[model samples]
Target: MPVRPADIDLAQRLADAAGAVIRPYFRRPAGLETKADQSPVTRADREAEEAMRRLLDAERSGDGIIGEEYGEKPGVTGRRWILDPIDGTRSFTAGRAIFGTLIALVEDGWPVLGVIDQPVQRERWLGVAGQPTLFNGGPTRTRACPALRGAIVATTSPHLFAEGDVPHYMALVTAASGGAPRQGPVYGGDCYNYGLLASGHLDIVCESGLKLYDFAALAPVVEGAGGRMCDWNGDPLTADSAGHVLAIGDPARTDEVLEALRGAVDDGIAHDH
Candidate 1:
């Protein structure tokens, strides 16, 4: 089903609810805990997600929920609400305002609506399928970059990449800098990078080790702003996609980015022999 106005409203409401829960804990110690994967989680993350879940249960009880903090909850409707109450827990712990709350409505595996809310900054980006993305209630479009050379690319961090995937990530960074010595990508921002890209402040964002809650909301925001968000192979993102994600502000640069990644993989294979 096409995304209805009501769905968009609910997404914004969800972000607002999450933001309200998270704001009080910003810059204050919130009882941090490490998950099994060594990722940090805090009371803010848990409480914010729980707040959003409560709203969903009351308003859209039939929709499935897939949250970063809480486990999945199945529903009768094929629609699912994917959420990451705090997309950058590390940044949040350090009191950086780059962290954000992510909410997306995925219907039958495709993201149809998304919201990226940075409560501390009071900035919000909402993207609905078939509509332009909005930043703080005003329409926004990504800047055009015709080529990979000189593109302002961003990734949360290289440390997050798996050992085998580091080279491929670096290859793209090198390509973006025009084959020069790798100057490195803009580090940090997490989901906030995607929001900036939607607002024309960034060009590309490449990330791996993401779950559905990470990129599902991002595709709508990026694509709605005349950009493209896809896998390394340039395939459209879906619920079942592997974690590798590439977001380019200009659609024209899609092929070039994909080629860079493919070249890296091929070079690795050649070296393995």
Candidate 2:
């Protein structure tokens, strides 16, 4: 079924709720802890997700929930709400405004609506399936880069990638810059990079080690803005995806980037022995 106006509206409200809770903790000394994987989590992340969950439980009790802080809460409806209260926790802790709150509604395992809200920047992007994306109450479109060469690329950080994955990522950076390191593919945007891609300021974002909440809201926003988002292997992103994500502002470059990534994988494997 097609996404409805109400779905989009609800998504906006959800983001707003999360933002209200998160903004107060931003830049302040937050209680931080390391998760099992050594990633950071803060009070801002927990409180924001709790705020959104409270709102969802009251408004749409029948919908399921998948959150970063808390685990899944299943409901009778096949539809689920995915929440990433703080997409760039490290950035938030550092007093950077690049972090965002991601909210998405997935129906029967497919995202139908998404919202990327940067509360500090007061910039929000809302996307509904089969419709144009709205950037801060106005329509937005992705810029076209017909080829991988010279295409601007951004990733959260190279440290997030596994040790074995660095060679593959370096290959992508080379392809994006035509082997010119200074031309393109700067680092450190996280989820904000995807928003930039939707707003025509960026060309590509490739990252690995993402969870459902990390990427659930992203595909719709990128696709709605005339871009394409999928796994590095060029498969459609889903709950079952392997967490390697590739988002491109211009769909034409999808195959080219994928081929480069595939070649990188092959090269890495060949050298493993």
Measured by lDDT, the strongest candidate is 1
Query: Which regions of candidate 1 deviate over 4 angstroms?
Result: 179-183, 267-273
List, residue by residue over 39-86, the lDDT tens digit for candidate 2: 899988999999999989988999999999998999897889999999
In angstroms, the error of model 2 at 226 is: 0.2
lDDT of 2: 0.86
Shift of residue 80 alpha carbon in model 1, Å: 0.5
232-264 in candidate 1: lDDT tens per residue?
777899998878888999999998887777677
Worst 10 residues of 1 by lDDT: 264-273
What are the C-alpha RMSDs, in order, of all predicted structures?
2.8, 2.7
- Which residue runs of candidate 2 sit more than 4 Å off their true CA positions? 265-273
C-alpha lDDT (0 to 100) for residue 21 of candidate 1: 87
